[model samples]
Each structure stands twice: as structure tokens, then as C-alpha cells.
Target chain A: MSSVTTTPVPRPATVARPTGRTAPVLRQLLLLALAVVVVAPFAWMVTTSLKDYADVYRPPYLWPQEFHVGNYGRAWDAAPFAGYYVNSLIMTGGILVGHVMLDTLAAYAFARLRFPLRNTLFLVLVATMLVPQFVTVLPAYDLVIRLGWYDSYAALIVPRMADVFGIVVLRAFMASIPAELDDAARLDGAGPWRSLWSVTLPLCRPALATVGMFSFLYAWNDFLWPLLVTSDDTHRTIQLGLSTFSSKYGTYPELLMAGTVTAAVPALVIFLFLQRAFIRGVASTGLK
Target chain B: MLAPTLVVIGVFVVYPIVGTGYLSLTSWDGFSEIKKWVGLGNYTRLFRDPAFLNSLWVTVLYGAGVCVAGVVSGLGIAVLLNGAFRGRGVYRAVFFLPVVTSSIAAATVWRYVFGDTGVLDAVLRFLHLPAPNWLGDPSLALVSLVLLTAWKSLGLNVVLYLTALQTLPADVYEAAAVDGASRWQQLRRITVPLLAPMTFFVVIEGLITSFQSFDLVYALTGGGPLGGTETLGFLTYREAFRLSHFGYGAAVAYTAFALVLGVTLIQWRLGGRERWSS
Candidate 1:
């Protein structure tokens, strides 16, 4: 009865009942196998990070014979990774902060405030999503240079704040909030800012979180722009810092794997905590 | 309210796009004062440039391979998860892990997995089976990168499909069950037809994302043993950054943009009501 209750479909009284329990069992088993395929690479990545060069070459076996705990340390010493991590943290924080603040305000205005050319502006924003980042990078690079921001954190964070994706996402979530709330807030003598802060902002948490999570991930993993802007080691991010292993120590698989593992952990941790936001971001954005 | 957004987009997104288009028709090395106008020269050179041509071919192959393989595998996994199950949440999370992992980091791990003395070869040797260099051969390298790309991107597809499946009303399945239709028959008749909209959306999104494929090549092959793995994304970077040919790079970027826009437009026109993901 419990199993029957949990089943997705209710069998109609007129239906001829077939053996359904075994079918679910088989499906579950198949899913488990597929899950293993999806997860094996990450498992290998971690296992190999602790692996010695010899054990790595002996790859039929995934578990290391002895944990070389020092690989992380060695990898850390091999490059200025500490500096890179700090820079990455700052860069990710700066970009996401701008994205969340600017996008939420814009989305609120679009959703509730009266303005001329609003619909046209929204359409232009939607169209911007279709343009690839490569097309914009060249001119943005020119702008950054003219502003004398090359090799600075602003180079990584500033232009990225103009996020059409975030604007659309925020607008979508804001539109779903009933206009009646804004009207009621206005009747209660709340200005647009007050209503946004008290009613709308509270409601927009999930959507804001979604945009924050994605743009943070985008800033964290960005490679090319960082490489283009920085001529020196001053403002290096984790992704750009990762190149030392390839350029200087290509022979050291252990170090490369360890550095990759180190570089990946923060993003993974963020994703784990923000998994729901990430899924909602992908799902609602797509379905819309 | 709109002043800030307009200013930012005008300065960054809108102006940048126009500038890029104009830059594609000129010659500039990114740092110099001189930008010589050369209309259609860059586009003509793109076709004649064997390296660029090879990359276009490679990108088309990679994009198609990843789309087909990723969608099929993702739908299969999603279907499996849709059945009554224990630990479904855990399974779903486990599957989605790769989509969050950095592309560069994922490619770096795959390099070892597919490299000469890497994981696959060792496993094959232990089992006394053949292990061809997965990333060595030009053709195989393209295939290998496609495999990695699909693996990295599959989680998004699965999650999307799962959401779509969940939103499907349960009564249809119940009705089918009452009629004694076989599970596969119900899937074919009801599920596939109903899922068409979701399928169309996923494919368009997938194709758009695939056109931006560059990080994998940068991390794994660097466009490879004899330009075998050079992709349009990589070519764009190489033209502007490596060679300092900003104008040419802008042109390569435009070509990619047009290619993506054309295919998307065609798919929009012809793919309406077609059996896309199937």
C-alpha cells in the first residue's frame, strides 16, 4: 500500500494490472549505472590529486597506494596560487555584487515603474543575449585600455556588470510578482524604493540568488579576458593562474592535477550550496 | 530607473557589438595607433586560410556530435529517473555535478583520462584490450573532445528534461495504463509527442552553447597536433590575441556569429513541429 501510494500514477479500476514493481526496480538499476558514468570523472579527479606520479601511471587502479598529501602543498608552492585565489575571490565578489544590485533595480523598474521606451529597451536586452561574448570582447578591451584599467581588477569586473542575461532573468522573476502588491505598498505611502526593499526584494530572493550564483561562476571561471587584460602577475585569477602548470611544469601531472583540484573546490562548494538556485536558474530561464 | 542600464549597455554591449563589426573590416594589431581599412579582405582570407577552414569543419563536427550524444544520453538518464525510485534526489545531484565543474578543470581531468599513459590506457592494458591514443589522432581528438563536451554539458540537459517530465500531468499515464498500453507504447504515443516543445527548446539552447566552445580546446589540446583540433572559438582567440590581428579576430568572431545565427534561423523556420530531439 505504501509503495502503491508512492507510485507516480494511480491505476484505474478498469485497467488490467501488470507487474509494475519489477519495472521500477530495473529502471532504478539503470539509473544507478548511468549515475556512475556521470560521477566517475570527478571521483577520478580527486583520487588522482592524491596520487603519486607512479600510481597515476598505474591507472587501472584508482585508489592511491599511499596518499601524497604534499601534492597540494607542492602545487601551491609551484605558483602564486594564494594571490590568485584572493584575486579570484575579489573579482567574483565584485562582479556578482554589481550584477545583483544593478540587475535587480533595473528589473524592478521594468516590472513596475513607468518609463518611456521601456518595451523597446527590454526587447533590445533580449536581443543582446543572442550576441556571443567574443564579438564584444574586442571593443571592451579597447574601452578598458582607454580607461587605463589594464592589469587591474576593474578590467575583470566592470564591463561584465552590464549583464543582459541577469537583467532578463531578474525581469522574469519580478514580472511574476503581482502588481497589486506594488499598488498596495503605494497606498500605504511606500515609495518605489521602499516597496522594492520591503515587499519585492524579499520575494525576489530566489531569483536574485540564481543570478548571483551564475554570474559568480562566470567570473570565477573566466580565462580569456583575464589573460587579455593582465600583462603581469598582479591581478591573476585561479583560472589564469592555472596556466603555470601547463606552461612551466607540463611534465608534473601530479602538480597539474592538484592545482586543478584546488582551483575547482571553491566553485564546487558554491554550486553545492546553491544547487537549487542553479537548477531554478537553468529551468525557468529555459522554459520561459 | 533606466538611465544606468542604458548607459552601461550603450557603452559596453551595444557599442562593443557595432565596434566589433566595424573592426572586422579593418586591420589593427590591438595595440597600435594605425588601423588600416581592408573591406572584405579578412573575410576572403578566412576562406583561403586552411587553418581557419579546418577549424570551421572541426567545430561543425564537434557541435553536431555533442548535440546528438548529449541529448540522447540525457533523455535516457532522465527517463530512468522519472520512474518510481528511491534515492532519486541523490542520483539527480550526482548527475548534475559535472555541469558545475569548471570547463577548464573538467577538460584537464579528461586530458589525463584520454592521454597516452592515462587512465583509459591503463585500464585497457590491465584487461588486455586495445587502447588507442584517445586525443592523439586528429579525427579521434575531435571525437574525444566531443565526448568530453557532451559529458560536461549533459547534466543541464538531464535537469531540464527531468523538470519537463515532472510537469507532465499524471492522468495521461494513468489513462494509458487503464488502456493496457505497453510502457514503451505510451512513451512513443504520448510522451514523445507531448515532449516535443521541450525538445525543441533544449536543442536550440544546446546549439547556441556549443558554438561558444573554446575552453576545452584551450585546456586540453591547445588546438592540437597539426591544427587538428582548432575550432572557430579558438581561431577567434588565436587571430586577435596570439597573432595580435585584432581586425582578423573580429572577423573570425563575426563569421562564427553569422554561422550560429543562420543555423538558428533555419532551425526556427524549418524545425517547427519537427521531431528534433528524437
Candidate 2:
């Protein structure tokens, strides 16, 4: 029976004979339907963003009567979006730098080095990942105020610089590297820091990219923390700015849609270009 | 090297968690020097507060709705895109688009979709169907929130399920097919059981994450239409920031945190013992 099962027999007829004729057609049809559900809201947003007042609220929805391209400009001018953009870029950049550096150092230590309480400390770090953000933001707010960091970049960037998830991802990636490489570096008169920088760091680029992408996305998309810390437009990030914009111009659906489009496009563009890496990164990480 | 990370975590995460616990036991208005020890008073009041109870109930309902819907739809899409096919990348990309979009931006568009003269209303009018207010009615408001969240969660679930599906042994399916098993039969018999571990992960993760959903509620409804959509997270925001009930808000946050921890612990217990045995 084992010999018969292992025998090389062309099983094309058996595998494809039943559903071969119509499976692809059915699959494509189902896929197209799901795709429409995902894309319709975005289509509605873009078309409505360009509509004049009448077309926005017209009976037949989705497409506008005419393309009023000035709405983006009007929406941009309606608020301090330029300042918000600068602030967001600064905050995201600061966070990425801090997050990558700190997480890399710590992850390298956890992965390669031997120290007292190493495993225990790592377990404690892992446990922190289970705490929800809402639980921390309240006291984090109080801390921000007490530290005189409120309404400043420190409040926005410092606390989020090093996350447990990023460290876990990096540490796992680092652990896969051969111990001989660091040993080789040490034999060449390089200290631990030197080896980590010149040897381990170069090879860990892919993991670093994953960590960077996630940190960028987190810092950029974060709303609640920024909302709690920042009090005015000077330090407001894009999401906060967009929220304020919508609340202030609640009646102007067209402009609000335009503003919405503006806010969403940067992240969408990045993901579109880097989706393969993004998907793989998230998949391999296996927990979000 | 770990010092900086330890310091940051200790200052921000660990301290905040302990602080949240301590804060819950006091009565503070967020400004005064006095904490006025309440000793579980807020927790007791929380059980009786109609608004708090409503929010707790709403959160559970919304979380369950998103978890079930997101997992089912995500599995469906993953199965549809499982094998190699033309336009597979396009379909995956399109479905994954909302996951990348910020909640505020997505919620802004959804607000219009559920608005009075919005897309849903227009479609209903064309079909001559009754168009109840999507975001206006209390009951319907929660449904709309579920729809938005589940949509946002779809891409992540699809990716996860697809990853797990790819790891499944193809020979099992081949053997089942040779035994005259139908596609539906193979899925029900072989694929479902094989993917149970992933399904468990997705479900638990979905519940924990959904309980903390705040951006959509903040942007889309502001927990509004007469507090119809106030989730526990939204309620925490209202109590602490809007109402200045710092102690009470801490209690609410702690309760939400506790639920998350409980689910996580359960996942570890069941998930560990199962040993990916499926």
C-alpha cells in the first residue's frame, strides 16, 4: 500500500478533473465582489472630495457632477495643515530614530550578550506588551504634565521611542545570526560595541527596516496619545489636525473629504510601494 | 544597553500600569493635590452607573461583532485567494488598503457613507428600501461602528489566515480530493481543523484590540447619537478628559485592561496546551 501510494503516477487528471472547468471563474467573481466592498468607500471619498455642494448631496451618489479640484487647496488653507505636516514629520522622524537605535541596542544585548537577570528582564519586557494603551495614557498624561513636557515634542516622542514589540521582533531576528561573526569581530580587536555596530548592525538591516516601517506607521497614525498631550495647533499632528478640521467644518462635506484624502494619501502611498515587505514583516512577526 | 529601554519602559509603561491601579482607588478631579482615598468606591459606583454599564455592554457587543465578522470574512477572502491566480496581487492590495489608512481618515469617509444623504441612503432609495439612519439611531449606530472596525481589521486577518493556509500540507487536500471529497467538504473537514490554531489567535487578538478601539469612535461618532456608541475606551476618555473624573476613568481603564489580560491568559493556557496540535 505504501509502495503504491509513493509510485509516480501522473495525477493531473485526478486533481483537476472535477473543478477544473469553472473554479477560476467562480474564484475571480467572488474576489471581484470583495474587492468592490473594500474600494467603494475610497472611491466615494475621492469623488465627493471633488464635488461641488450640489453634487455632494445629490440623489445618485459616488461620482460628482464636475471635478472641483480647488477643494484640496481650500481645505489646506482652512487650517494650519502646513504646520501640522511639519510637526508630524518631525515627530515621526524623531520617533523612528529613537525607536530604531534604542530597540536595536537592547535587542542586540538580549540576543547575543550574557548578563545577570537577562531572561527575567526579557520576560518582564514581554509582559509589558500585554498592557493596553488606554490603560497607560491616563497616567502617562499626568506624567507628561508633571514633567513639564506637555505640549512639547518630548511628550510626543520620548515615551514611544522604545516599544517592547519592536525589541521582540529585532531580538528574534538577531538570535538567528551565527555567534561566530561577533566572535570573529572580537578577535580582530573590536569591543562589544564595535562588533555590534560594524558586524551585527549591517546584517540586521531587513529587521531594522521592518522595525522602522512599523514605528513610522505607529507614530504617524497615533491619535490618542497626541490628542492627550498636545493642547494646540502648534504641536498637533496630522490625525489630530484632521479631526479638528472635520469638527470645525462639519458642514463642508466636500472640503472635509478633501482633507481626509490628504491625510490618508501619504501612508497609503508608502504601503502601496512597500506592500510586499510590509505584508511579510507583519506575517513573520506573527503577533500585532 | 538594556538600561535605556528599561528606563523608558519603567517610566512610561510599568509606572503607568501601577499608577492606573493606584489611581482607581482614589477620588480625584484631575487637578487638586488631594486624591481623597475612595477604596473601591469608584468601582462600586461603576457597577451601578447606567452609562458605564451601557458602555461595558456596548463594548462587549461591538467586540464580539467585529471578531466574528472580521474572522469569517477574512477567512472567506483568504480561501478565495489561497491558490495562485491572476490578479491575486491586486485583490490582496485592494483589500489591504484600509488597513494602512488612518482610522481618522477612514472614519471621516464612513461618516459620510452613513450620513443622512449618504451613499447607504442613496442606494436604499434606489432600491426602494427603508433607509433607517445608520449613525443616528442608537442600535444602528453600534452596527455602523462594527462595520467600520471589522473592515479595518480585514486586511490583518486575511494576511494571517493566508499565511497559515499556505503552511497547511497540500497532500492532505490531495488525498481528500482523491477520496472524492468536494471542495466544501475538504474545507469543512480538513482545512478548518488544520487552521484552528490560527483561528484561535485571530479571535483572541481581535477581541483584545477591538476593546481598545478609540480612533473610529472619536472621529466618526464622538461616542454620540445620545451615547449610543460609547465604548469603554470612549467612556474612559469622556470620564477623564471630558468629565474630569480621573479616578473613575482609571477604574474604567483598569477594567478594560483586566478583560484584555484575562483573554490573553486564556489564550496562553488553551493555546499552549493545544501545542499547535491541529
TM-score of 2: 0.95
Identify the CAPRI category of the predicted complex in candidate 1.
medium
Reference A-B contact fraction recovered by candidate 2: 0.71
User: For model 2, how does the per-residue alpha-carbon lDDT over B1-278 read when each residue is reduced to its tens digit?
Assistant: 88898899999999999999999998888878999899999999999999998998888898889889988998889999887655777788888899889999999999989988788888888899998899989889999999999888798999989999999998999999999999999999998888888888888778877788899999989998888889998999999999999999999999988888787778768763353332
User: What clash pairs does model 1 have?
Assistant: none
Q: Record all residue pairs in model 2 with backbone atoms less than 3 Å apart, i.e. clashing.
A: none
Error of 1 at A5 (Å): 26
- Most accurate candidate by TM-score: 2
lDDT of 1 by residue, B1-278 (tens): 56677787888889999999999999999989888999989999999988888988888887788778877887778888775445766777787788877877888888878989777777788799998988889988888888888888787888888878877899999999999999899888887778776677677766776677778888888888677788888888888988999999999999999998988788777653443332
What i-RMS does each candidate reach, in Å? 3.7, 3.3
lDDT of 2 by residue, A67-111 (tens): 899999999999988899889999999999999999999999999
Candidate 2 residues lying further than 4 Å off, grouped into runs, are A1-23, B272-278
Candidate 2 lDDT for residue A271: 92
